[model samples]
Target: MTVAEIFPWQQVLWQQIRQPENLKRHHALLLKGRKGIGKLGFAFGLTQSVLCGQVDAAGVACGKCQDCYWFEQGLHPNFRLLEPEALSAPGGAAGKENEEGRVEAAGTKSGKKPSQQITIAQIRSLDDFIYLSAHQARDKVVLIHPAEAMNTAAANALLKKLEEPPEGVLFILVAHGASLIPATVLSRCRQIAMPAPEHKLARDWLVRQGITDPDFRLAISGFSPLLALQHDEQQSAPHADFIQSLCVPEKFDPIGLAEKLHKQDLSSVTSWLQKWCYDLMSSRISGRVRYHLQQADSIKRQAALMNPVAVGFMWRNLAASQQLARHPLNSRLFLEELFLTYGELIRPVGSETR
Candidate 1:
């Protein structure tokens, strides 16, 4: 995968992090924003700038410099990237765990899928790296992506380090939500809000990538074009029938729909239903649909029949269903129960009791 140094949208935040006055006072940067918006990529860019001894006028790393070469090679001694063991890739961080003085996680060899967590052990491992003298004479940089993966114990352990970060240490936390970190930790860091790119900018970027349905993908992924590619926005033959069936909620056959949907994965089943419910809710108030841009008129027609209060309850039910979506229960029965409940909330006008 080709990694971008930074996206066009990140220019302003890039400047903020590079500003000497701002960079000097802050030991930690909280890169908070929506998922898949390139926060971690931005963190990598910032690391290059801070560690590069010969930065130019714009504060960007000069690609020809020694520091830049070392960083690009992922051999920069002062740089450390902390993420879940499962999420961590070889050479993405400084080096192998033992070689770079990182904690050797015993859990990786368990033969199960590696953890999706940055366990307390990972956080505590920083004790040696952060406090150690910089190997290359530049400041030490620790990049943490998807910071929300840290559990309660890990978050608490990190609070102390953030509060009194070691001199010459830069802690960059890339996360979707700021509140996911403890209040004490948050207060100690400088937060940089990364907003989704403007429509035209995101569209232009996606066009360069040769995406066919740029606008539709952008709409469905909540305006984060980068995230758009991760979802299958195209309605294929199998999903097409299921999607169309959602427009007329009142006509749903719980058993038939459940049987059809359970054949698909539980996550996809719930996500599509949740998106449908969200469109209903959005059309109820705004007369516009987000994900179902092509079916806007149909969505509005359905919205006209349903009361917002009724749709609100449907949304809550959908949320509950999503939370339980991971359970390996009888998928068909689970979906049948959900569809039955959905049918009630979205019953036709005349079907409502007097």
Candidate 2:
């Protein structure tokens, strides 16, 4: 069996932490970083290594071992993974949990939309895993991904466990927004600030994955390699359409665009608008475009004719929109309102000649 690969950028960190002594010192690890930087993959790699029946001198999992087999099959008696039910749903966040690549969660077999927030029931269900003796008397590992997704009740429930952690059990919490997690919970874990790769490094990694126009994807993904890959595979068309419409603000039909995008993830759609406005503000003030390098010319033109103060306000307003995007009462109405507001920010290309 081949050991799953960790991202190249993580090699240094992996080397430093893979030592058995390092892992033995911590009962819980909080792996925090920007979205799509592969925190989940790192956590899984660490878990596999720790549970492997045979580990190398470098403390890497021997995938050929029985424990590795169990892990790959998702039937490891000693391992449990906790994540929002939404993530397990079709077309949902997957490993893309935060701003860069959140997808709308689909409904479960019961036709109910899977929840985006981790519930208290999930935390409570861990009782057996946390209290019961580990299989074969080995260490038990419980991994909660995007720990911030836990609601207040869930968080409080987990806090009780963290406060008096049982021996031989390891809790690994992965979070994109660690600040959203409770301070009391954070204090109980060994926090690790996961690293994002440099531009060149991330670009190189994307290239190796056969991504074309890697830089554009990388920039739009907030420089996260995993999110960049996700954009290439899943989001390319909708994103391009959204940008093209924005490029021609005069021809932009908010209702039409909203109609087209309402079926998509509200959070993701809002994020695109947020990034576009960010570029607009950035262009107007500093003559720079951050996310939309391909649309620099259009952004520059639009920025020149817009009010920097108004754009600044609009950009800030979108932050609130992001929060609302999660559970909007009417997605179409929400988007229509969003685009209509953007339409007000930009005058037609030739409306005012310099």
How does each model score on lDDT?
A: 0.74, 0.86
Per-residue lDDT for 1-354 in model 2, tens only? Answer: 112457888898899888777888889999999888888888888889888989888778889888999998878999988888888677675655445435466778999888878899999999998898889999889999779989999999999998898889899998988999999999999999998999999999989988988898889988988878777456679989999999987788989999999988788888889899999989988999989998999999999988888889998998999889978999999999998888877765456531
Highest lDDT scorer: 2
Count of backbone clashes for each model? Answer: 0, 0
Q: Across residues 94-157, which tens digit of lDDT does each residue of candidate 1 receive? A: 2211111122223345555566577899899889888878876568898876687787888888
Model 1 weakest lDDT span, ten residues long:
94-103
Flag regions of model 2 displaced more than 4 Å: 1-5, 94-103, 232-235, 253-256, 259-266, 323-333, 348-354
Candidate 2 lDDT at 76 equals: 90
Stretches of candidate 1 exceeding 4 Å from the true structure: 1-4, 53-56, 62-75, 89-113, 233-239, 248-251, 350-354
